[model samples]
Target chain A: MDVLINLSLNGLATGMLIFLLAAGLTLIFGLMDVLNFAHGGLFAWGAYSGIWIYTATGSFLVGIIGAILTGMLLGILTERWIIKPVYGNHVQQILITLGLMLVLSEMLKVVWGPNQISASTPSYLSGSWEVGGVIIIKYRVFIIAVGLAVFLAVQYVLKKTKIGLVVRAGVMNKEMVQSLGINIQKVFMLVFMIGAGMAALGGMLLGPYSGVIHADMGMEFAILAFIVVVIGGMGSFSGSVMAAILVGLSGSFMAYYVPDLALAANMLLMAVVLIFRPQGLFGAKG
Target chain B: MTRILSNRMNILYLMIAAFLAVLPFVYDSRSLLILLSQVFIFAVLAMSYDILLGYTGIVSFGHAMFFGIGAYTVGVFMKRFEPETSYFLLAVVVTIVLTAVVSYIVGLLTLRLKSHFYAMLTLAFAGLFLVLAEKWRTVTYGNDGFTFRVPEFLRDRTDFYLICLASMVVVFILLKRFTNSPLGKVLQAIRENEQRTESLGYSVLQYKIIASVVSGVLAGIAGILYAVSLRFVNTSVFTMDITLDALLMTIIGGVGTLVGAIIGAGIIEFSHHWLTELAKVHWIFERWIIFFGIIYILVVMFFPMGIVGSLKKLKFSRKKKDSVPVKSETVSQGD
Candidate 1:
């Protein structure tokens, strides 16, 4: 029972991090029909910038904000310069974003040096709580809280605000949204920025959780995020959370029980999902 | 006009073949021969990719899986058996069969998906194979891939170079015939409009699977040659880098044009070689990938259709201004 609880908690934390990344990717894909392979680059940049800020300022909150701002800046540049050109052509988007992913990771090397950087949990979030013979790590709980908060905030904004309505409508039909007199391009840029910020936030949080961060972490996690997005169904927000948890729990459990199959477990999950329900758990027939 | 174009293409092929025939003796530099062989191997790989991406419009991100399958088969087989011509032949046969089977299954599972989903799923699947190669130490030797001996004939660099060049030329000619075939024309039609082809009662999935199998088999052959070229094989063969290299070559050279694959492969391999050499001169040049990325960006921005593709477009457009072209009529005749 204790082991199960610990695993579930660990899985939940990991899933939440993935959800943060996938949420942005799915929404961006939905709204713009652009597969931003460089989304992982944003995540890596976020982690590096956030961790760097935290170390410099000695304030974790400042670090987080710094990461978000860095992500938005990068996102704005990527959207304006890189992504803007290949809007509807997926092959071009994939190729260009892939190139950008390489550039981002290489730039991280150029900026941060090639060595992996070790990160520490902030003093406020360093301890663990023991309850009923089970120990729950504070950082994991913190990640879960942040993830839920972000999700709720996004949901509320998407549901209650006019801009959110416009964004949602854009996802449904870009032409219809444009016909409704909204500057769909502006919405696209905004959505891309928000999505990139979320990915960076995920990367920043992931740094301390993993206890060490590397430039290439973004690509590996981006693959996981893509898996979550696929499993949850593309363009579905709440579905991302659900699928991420599923992947995270499966990964955690598989790692403990069947180490040999652990790495393949998530891929197997994705393959099974693709074969049985290509539409995804929460996706419409798009 | 079409006859003139064909004659020009044929002369170009003859000239290239003549150049390759004399390259080994004229250069006499072992390094240059090795580099040319590598280019030939990759050109074959890129051509296989073009059959799918350019001809059928299936953008696969897991092509390296098939290539790795071919390479690993040879590596494992040669390591287990004596290095003999028969053993090499056996390895090639096994690699072909395995790549064809695997690609057929993958294509069946994935070809149904729309663009982005298909690409992502293919990547995920390839990642699974990479992990398996890393974990299955008993067979794959883990990340430190094992080296094995080849036949005596293959041990000679000139012999290997000639063989590789011959294989590339043969594959290119065969693929050219394939893309010009009636079925190939249908595949091109499917690329242009899948829904209309489906309405026309062509089984899009079947045609895609056929293309996948052919491409997979060819990639596997390239993998065998690649493995033999180095006399070494490792999990790196399965990396996304390999697939991306093929993709970049296909896109940069010319998507649908068969000759573009070779030119693209040459340009990329030569640039990589030259860049590495330049890295010794300047520390800043060590980061060659940034330059590579910049090239991709510029290509996408400016040469959206690729080098050969854009040139062809320019010529075609000019001809259109001169006279109404019957290219569409000829294409319809092929169908």
Candidate 2:
């Protein structure tokens, strides 16, 4: 029972991490119809920057801001330089973004040695809370709480704000949104920045949760994020959140029960969904 | 004049092949041999990728699935070999058959999906195999993979290269045949106009399945060579990088052109060999990948058609000074 609880917490923590990374991915793809393979690179940078700040200043809150800012900056750069020109052409977008992914990955190594760095939980988060003979790690709870908070905050913004309406309208039809006399470029910039911010936030939390931060983690996690985007329907923020949790819960459970099938299970689910409904769970029809 | 030119092109091909055949003499023999074998294997993989990407206008990111199938099939065969089985022949037939079957099954499941969904799903399949290779460690040897100690009949470079060369040549001829055949025409037809082909009472799914099966078999052959050449088979060969490499080679050499695969493979393998040597510093390989990515982006954006493809276009345009410009016809201008 204790191990189960531990694993469950672990799974939720991981799921939250995935949701953070994937939320931006889902939104970017949903609105832009652009497949940004380089999104992971931003996530990695976020972790690196956040952790670097955390270690230097010994302030977790500052690290989070640092990570989010780093991601937003990178997002602006990529959106302005790489993604802007190749907006419509997928092949070009794929090529440029893939190139960006490589650049970001390489840049990480240049700044930080190629070796993996072990990141620690904040001093306050290092301990555990024991209740009813079960010890729950405080950090995991912190991650879960932060993840839910972000989710709720994003939902609040998306549902209530004028910017959210514009984002939705753009996803429906970029031209139509433009025709409405709103500066679509401004919206793109805003969305791109926000997406980058989310990815960074994901990276910051994932750093301590995994206990090891590496340049390559972004690519691996990006693959999962992409899978979530595909499963949840690209652009459907809610869809990505739900799918990320599903993937997270299932992966955790499977790892415990049938370790051999754990990795394949998510992929199997994707295959089944893709084969049966190419639009994804909540994907809009083409 | 046309016949004479054709003869010259043929001779040029023969000379290039002869030069490649003897390249090991000048370079480090062991490294050159390994590179040569890799070039051939990737050439086959690239060719198979071209069948889906260049010819069919479908960019499949998960082609490594078939390549992995080929590798895993041979590994399975050797692992559970019968006492009397001929390791060489048995491995070849089994890998091809099994890979073809797997491709056929995959085709049935995925052929209906549009480009993006199918592409993502195929990528998922590639990841699936990698996960399986590591997860199902018992049969697959998981991350460690398995080793196939060659039977006494074939051990040296000369013998192995001969098998590789013969297989490649045969597959080449087979692909040539496929491109000229009625089925190939139908596949191209589907690529050009799916509705038109459907209206003509043809089944796009059937054609795609057959092509995938054929491509899978060829990839399987290459996989066997890959294993036998390295004297190793691991899950790493099934990773996204391998798929990316194959895709890179296919795109670089010029998609859809029959001979482009070999050129792409040879150049890339040579580049990799040299780069690996140069990338002694830890961050060098990552930089090299970034450089390649830059080149990839440029090539895809400006020269959308690949090296050989653009050259072919140049030649065709030159042949007829005005020949009704072909670019406007093929390159879609707008949605």
Candidate 3:
């Protein structure tokens, strides 16, 4: 029972991290119609910057904010200089963004050295809480809270705001949104920055949970996030969240019970999703 | 064929072929052998990538999976059997068979996924191969990678170079023929408009799977040759870096052109030397990443059609300008 509870907590914490990454990726794909292969670069940058801050000051909160800011800055640069020219062309977008992913990953090695950096939870949140023979880690609970909070906050913004309506409309039909006198380009940039910020925050939170951060780490996680995005729906925020959790729980459970098939399992889920619903579970029909 | 190749282009190709044929004689023997072999292998990989991305409009990120299957086929066979088995005959038969079966299964499963979804699934598949290879160290020999001895005939570097050269030329000609054939036309049609082709009664998914399988076989060839050239094979050959390297090579040379794949591979591989040379003169250009990044950006931004594509377009414009006087005379006659 305790083992089950522990796995559940671990799964939820990891799922939240994935959700954070996928949330931004889904939004960017949904709103901009751009497949940013370099999205993982933003995640890595967040991890490096946030960890650097945390290491220098011994404050996790500062590290978190610093990482988010780093993502925002990199996001702005990516959109303006790198992403802007390739906006309508998928091939070009992929080529450039893929290059950027390489550059961003290599840059981490340059800045922080190639070795993986260790990150630990603060002492207050390091231990576990037990009740009725079920034990849960406090930091894992904190991660779950942060994930839920980010999800709910985004949902609230999407549901109750004019910007959200424009975003949804844009996702539905960019031409229609343009016909309505809204600057769709600005909206794209905004969504891209926000998505980058979310990915950054996800990276920061993931740092402690995973116990280390490395540059190439983003590509591996980004692959999973991309899988979640596909399974959920490219532009569907809610779908990304649910799909991320599904992937997280499945991966967590499988790693323990079926270690050999664990990696293949997530891929199999994605393959199945692609076969059955190519537009994705929550994606609107093209 | 005469109409396809003008006299000048023919000479250019003959000249390049001659250079490749004699390259081993001039350069440091081992480096030339390895580099030339690498060029051949990568040329094959790049050409296969063109079949999907340039012609079919399906971008795949898991191309290495097929390449790994090819290497693993050779590795598994070499371990279980003898190296003296009919060298070229056996490797070709086994690689094509093994790659075909594996690609068929993967193609059937993944061919239905659209756009980025399909591409990402392929990436996932590659990662799966990587993890399996890493953890199952006993059979795969794990991360250390396995090496098998080449037959005595292949051990002779000059003879081996000839074999690689012959394989490349044959494959190159076949790819060119395939691209201009009716099937190639159908692939182009699918790329331009899949639904329109579907409405015209074409089986889109079947064609995609077939093309994917064929390309997979070609990549498998490259991987097998690569394993032989290095005197060993490892999962590193199937790394994401190799997949991206092939993509970059294809994009840089000419996505749809067979000649362009070879040219692209040559340029990218040779740049290691070029950049190394440049480093002696300037500190600013010391980093290979910066050079690659800048060139990649330039290519995607300004010459997205690629080096060969741009040159083709230039030739087209020049022809138009040359015929202006004739066009004017014809217009006057009509008037």
Leading candidate by TM-score: 1
lDDT for each residue of candidate 3 in A1-286, tens digit (9 for 90 to 100)? 7777778788888899999999999899888877888888899899999989998999989999999999999999999999897677766677788888877887777678778999888888798887787877889999999999999999988889999989988988999999989999899889899899999999988888889988888999899899899889889999999998898898889888888887789888877777788777777753
Clashing pairs in 1: none
TM-score of each: 0.95, 0.90, 0.92
lDDT (10s digit) by residue, model 2, range A104-141: 88788878878999999989999899999999999999
In DockQ, how does model 1 score against the reference complex?
A: 0.68
Clashing pairs in 3: none
Determine the backbone clash count of candidate 3.
0
> Lowest-scoring 10 consecutive residues by lDDT in candidate 3 chain B?
B326-335
Better of 1 and 2 by DockQ: 1
Task: Tell how far residue B215 is off in model 3, in angstroms.
Answer: 1.2
Better of 2 and 3 by lDDT: 3
Off by over 4 Å in 2: A1-4, A284-286, B1-8, B19-30, B79-85, B189-202, B280-287, B319-335
Give fnat, all candidates.
Answer: 0.63, 0.46, 0.49
lDDT string, candidate 2, B157-258, tens digits: 766665676666677768877887998888778777777898999988888777777777777777777877776789987787777787778777877786
Worst 10 residues of 3 chain A by lDDT: A86-95
What is the clash count for each candidate, in the order shown? 0, 1, 0
Candidate 1 lDDT over residue span B1-335, tens digit each: 46634787787787889899898888789999999999999999999999998898878888899889989999998999999989999999999889988888888888888878767877877888899999999999999999999988899999999999999999998999899999999999998889999999999999988999999999999999999999999999998889988988887897888788899999999988998899899865667767767887778766766888888777766776567655432211111
The top-ranked prediction according to lDDT is 1
lDDT of 1: 0.89
- Cα displacement (angstroms), candidate 2, residue A132, comes to 3.1
